[model samples]
Target: MKRLFRILIIGLSTLALAACSQIATDANSLFVSELTEKEDAILSIASDKSFVFDFHIDSEYKEASVWIEKYEAGKLVDDRLAHLTTEVEQSGSIIVTLSENTNENNNSFNIGVGTDENLTSINVSDTDLIGLESMASVWGSTSEKVAIDNGEAVLANISYSDDENGMHSLTTDFFEDAAGHMNELEKYDVAYLLKVEFVK
Candidate 1:
């Protein structure tokens, strides 16, 4: 019986070690591979008379043109929205949209972008109670541009204050190799998305 028990323990130990080794070897591919750019869009609009322009792209956008027209007295008054050019990431897609927010007899336009789960969000505060409110953005080299509402405080050093709401995150191929994995990380085809609603 003693010999049998020893053998059983040794077998279990070997199996556990092998499982761990396999997990370590496969972790890189399982979590980091097959990433492709899915979206990227950037639109710059210029106009007078303070008119609001709202645009939204559900998926990847190709080369496109933007036109804004002004009207007066039931006729075309001016169509001088010019000097516009579109520059998009060669592989990724970013959806952009605009909406109206009314607050205390005031009007503002809200911009919204879509997002994914791969984002590395850091919770600054650990509590059910909420804290101060402010607007902030967290950015990194590989990370896509993200916007957030009032929640966690952004430190001057770009770190973070507490793990709270409104805290932003990072996502990209930068993390795969940076974490000391075997596979090299490359820019994913899918770009991060941004969306929000606030009284302006």
Candidate 2:
């Protein structure tokens, strides 16, 4: 009876090993082999306005999706901005509209997604305020541009204070861009940042 019990123990151990191996294989199958290639297709927008943009992609079980968000004055504005769910046949896309809030001399805007899942691309366009016009020259600098590119998932922490305030009539124009970088991958994820500052 002791020898039979030993044999049963060995059998159970072998079965456990097999189950673990199967689980690993299943996990590996969920990832796409060429994720970065598709991630690079996303285009970068110039950071010359008051809005910032960020984008990223994530995958599971051979399926992938994208997430995007935006902010203003250190506060989240786009809570349900956009999303894309990837599949075998076709990928899905989500687009969000921006709402404007005008209250006396203080105008505000917002953009973002409520979910933490991966996102394919995110684009943000805001009117160029007078406060950002003076900083236009700085936008062409490489370092500032790099900062904008890397600030997508963060608040961008960019702001300017006014000393003398008297009806600062602000005006801006809308900008547009897109990304199809993750199309070639079967599974993958990528993230990016975009920043725009307005000057007068």
Candidate 3:
């Protein structure tokens, strides 16, 4: 009986390991980006306009959150410019809209995530937030330009802190990787999406 129990335990362990491996494989293809100018060195847009993102998500994900990160000259400036959490249906197209507001010396941005309508909208307008000089500079002149590194997205659920800046910022330890990079996503039965882009 002892030997039989040991065999059973070993078999269960192997099955568990296999299941973990399958999940890792699925993660790689869970999110698909459909940006037309993804490879462009710089994506130019009006300071008071919105950029729309159309992507594909696996049917397994029913709920997800999308956020943005600002980068300048190959460095991170803001990790949570905007965040939107919403529910998703089966495998289909997911649209995320990022709207920027830089008027009258005031800088802010909003994110909307949903299929055909704005299911969730998150607005962020804080002066203390980093990576605003670019948007601020473009308020008065068209020749002035500020460039950032690039835009990328990841999937994971993370914690945020609103007490610091009156807006949400990454405050969870598990959301980062060993190198303290925001790309290291932490999963808590939900999905997180991020996009980083530099203006040149």
Candidate 4:
């Protein structure tokens, strides 16, 4: 009788785990399907499909000076005229920058169309900025897709978690160079950072 009871418990645990797995799979499918639909529609109707490089870094940017700010510390510094001039090519991983000592916040960045059907990919590469946290979609967009960043916040948190090792990482893998079904025409406004003062 004891052996039979043990078997029953084991069976129940297995069932529970299997159920959880199924649930996760189903949820992911639904999410991906929805995202694909929206992205397809957006791309289908997009007028300006040219490869665009809209990036700016603060002129006052000093290497390793702008540390990741803590979550609770409100805007510590501000800078106007922080956007420095830059030259960008069609589609490749070029380091774009933003700085607190500039006009706009660097952490919160944007990526999207430029000017026909020239651009074929979404700019999904490494970034050398602060951090990210989820809120009402990344940067106010609805299709906040999966991201593989060095060790920053990840929305679509349904898929991944923060890297355990706390190292300064500067990379993001969104729609990597026409690899995914959803290509360009998706404007990305990422807002996933926890600001802190300069760290050691």
Candidate 5:
């Protein structure tokens, strides 16, 4: 009888521990891609797609900053894609949207970042698009051109946790580039940082 009682207690303890472990994992879930260790890697996303990052900034953090950048040859080319700063605690999703050039009336791609109803935008003209196309030779990806020509987009998303080991989007396989080119991201320590890149 005592042996059976001990076995039941052990089983219950194991089940309780598993439930707690699952809760912790679900609470701290972040995006991690297979190419996370590679450098100068890009994620090819279709046009008209949006990447949404849900975040909650602790009040201990006085401020929050968000921005988007473009890289070539492991160097940052454009740093002003979308930028936002907030003084109060922000708890919402940071959305990055990519819109293709469908008509000659608007032969430009607009990269927009929004939190709820507030939004910030940047306009990339055809001339800028051509410049991006020329940089593709360095990556040696012919498909990159096809994607770019088809108005596809690429973004590097990075998230920083309390552990100080940041999490990055699947496409930004290059930890070196993400680490080196923080571009003022380090200034404002964010609990969760999502760096977006739009290529069209």
Candidate 6:
């Protein structure tokens, strides 16, 4: 009787652990699509300019790491950036600063990770600047597609327009998944920083 009770307890414990693992796997799978989008956008943007876009991966079952890719003329020009492992707390923020040689004026953009609480704003010197409007238009179109495909239900609350500074700002709360999950594993909010600065 004692042996039977011990075996039953062990079986129940194993089943419980397996169930928990399945739940985590399902939750993590929902985030895979979002992660793919980030990679596609980053690769596409990198192909156009010689710059680095750093990605911070966060996962409980796997080691977190950063993947960097460089691009120029719509192709990966080089792999100057290195991949680095990260901690769980530092997983959400993916900062991609343009190399100094790429942006001679030191003008750069910083995008937020999982929220629009901290957005990057461009600074345009002239009110009649054509480049600023063009940049805003390009970003608006690209971001709209990403937002819709991601099923960001609150996308209506997001807006992309120019500010009084002649600079363009894309502000929106459409950064989370359909289930209202924060999806911090993927940096969806960093889309704004993917814009390319044209050389004058």
Clashes of each: 24, 29, 7, 14, 3, 2
Better of 3 and 5 by lDDT: 3
Query: For residues 84-116, could you state the per-residue lDDT of candidate 6 as single tens digits?
Result: 333322112233322112223222222212211
TM-score of each candidate structure, all chains considered together: 0.18, 0.23, 0.37, 0.16, 0.39, 0.24
| Order of quality (TM-score) | 5, 3, 6, 2, 1, 4
Compute the lDDT for candidate 3. 0.35
lDDT of each: 0.22, 0.25, 0.35, 0.22, 0.32, 0.26
Q: Any idea how many clashes model 6 has?
A: 2
lDDT of 5 by residue, 70-148 (tens): 4432345566544655442223333333433433322223333333324444444433333222111111111111111
Which residue runs of candidate 5 sit more than 4 Å off their true CA positions? 1-47, 88-90, 102-127, 131-177, 180-200
Task: Give the Cα-based TM-score of candidate 4 against the true structure.
Answer: 0.16
Candidate 6 local Cα displacement, residue 15, angstroms? 34
> What's the CA error at residue 182 for candidate 6, in Å?
29
lDDT of 3 by residue, 1-200 (tens): 22332332233333333333444333212332223352121123322323333333445555555565544432455667675557753222222322333333233555544443224455565354333333211111011111211123332222222223233323334222313654322311111234422111
Write down the RMSD of all candidates, one decimal each.
Answer: 25.0, 21.5, 19.5, 22.1, 18.9, 19.4
The superposed Cα distance between candidate 3 and the true structure at residue 101, in angstroms, equals 5.6
lDDT computed for candidate 6: 0.26
- The residue-by-residue lDDT of candidate 1 on 166-198, one tens digit each, is 443343443322234212211211111122221
